[model samples]
Target: MQIKPLIGALGAELLDIDISAPLPPDTLAAVRRALFDYQVIVFRDQKLTLDQHKQFARQFGPLHVHPYILAKPLDGHPEVLRVVKEKDDRRVFGEKWHSDVTFLERPVLGSVLYAIETPSKGGDTLFANMYMAYETLSDGMKAMLEPLTAIHETPVPEVDPATGRPLEPMRLVNKRGEHPVLFTHPETGRKLLYLNTTYVTHFKGMTPEESRPLIDYLCEHATQAAFTCRVRWAPGTVTFWDNRSTQHLPINDYHGERREMHRVTIET
Candidate 1:
């Protein structure tokens, strides 16, 4: 397989490997290495079935089952989240910047998203390099962040997407945890910004109001133009991103068209 850089900051496209079938041992190793090196990797024209998609992701780690999710697991595949946005839907599932499920005690290693159907245009996903975000910070900022821990939570939806049933508070408690602001990538041993606006509410010893300014400042700094890359989607395209080293946002610009994708989150 050939790997081509998608952008200067991060992302690479791997060509000539069909993920529908099991990849050779060396190719799988190469794929893993590319993900670590580039932060984001895409495979085009690989029409992977749900099982095949899970199979490929399982090679990296165990699949994650989202806790108390709004979207139902696709059919019988508990590990796969079938993300769909209809033509008339006002909002998409992941409209904000986040590393998937950061509230979990052990956040996922990464995500494997396979496109089953995509809008004709304008449903691109943007990934920001968190490693670059941490590296570019001033020494004083890094020194301050090194000893800080951010509180994260999974924000529950008001209603279930599949049932339209109003969710009760008892069934909707947020899953909360704490993680260091400057996290060391477990395998790569590199520092990365580990904060996300979606889940993180405050620092360990600070209130939300007290932490807002610094949180906002860091969020703004982390996602600067030079640290990001945009990936366009296709019917058979698959993308994998190292969640520990990146934050991603899915554009909801395809309001007039339908888009469907299957996602599997791999454990670290």
Candidate 2:
């Protein structure tokens, strides 16, 4: 497989490999190395069945079953999660920046997403390199963050603006956990900015009000343009990202357009 960088900081695209078929052991090893090196890798123009997708992801580790998503898993494949937005849907999932499933005590190690349907325009996913975000911080700031742990919780349903009634309840799983503010990569031995706007609510010993300023500052700083890359989606495209070392935001610009994707999360 030929690997090419997608952006200066973090992403790379892999070419000439058909993931629908089994990969050779050496090639799989190379792919794992590239994932750790780049944090996010994309494979374009590939087709995969739901089973094939789950098989490929399981090669990395056992797949994770998302506890809170209301959508049912694909038949016979409990590990696969369907992410779909209909043409008239105005609300979008994953529009905010986050590392997947951070509310779990053992958060997902990584995620593999395969695009089966996409809008004609405006459905790109942005990934930020948290390793770079942490590395670039001032020593004083790094020192302060190293010992801190932050709380992460799954979101509750919002009240509908039209009727002033709560939206249908989403299944609440294990909703909360505390993780280190600076997460160290288990394989790369590098520190990453681990707090996110979506799930992280406060530092361990501080109230939400007291943690607001610093939390806001860190969220803004970690997602700066220089540390990020945007992947424009198309059918037959698959992207894998190390959730431990990066944060992602899916753009919600394509209103009145349909988009569908299948995802598998690997255990860390």
TM-score for each predicted model, relative to the true structure:
0.95, 0.95
Candidate 2: C-alpha lDDT:
0.89
The regions of model 1 sitting more than 4 angstroms off are 159-170
Kindly give the number of clashing pairs for every candidate: 0, 0
Clashes of 1: 0
For model 2, the superposed segments whose C-alpha errors exceed 4 Å read: 159-165, 169-174
Cα lDDT tens digits for candidate 1, 61-112: 8999988557558889999998898887877886788889899998789999
The candidate maximizing lDDT is: 1
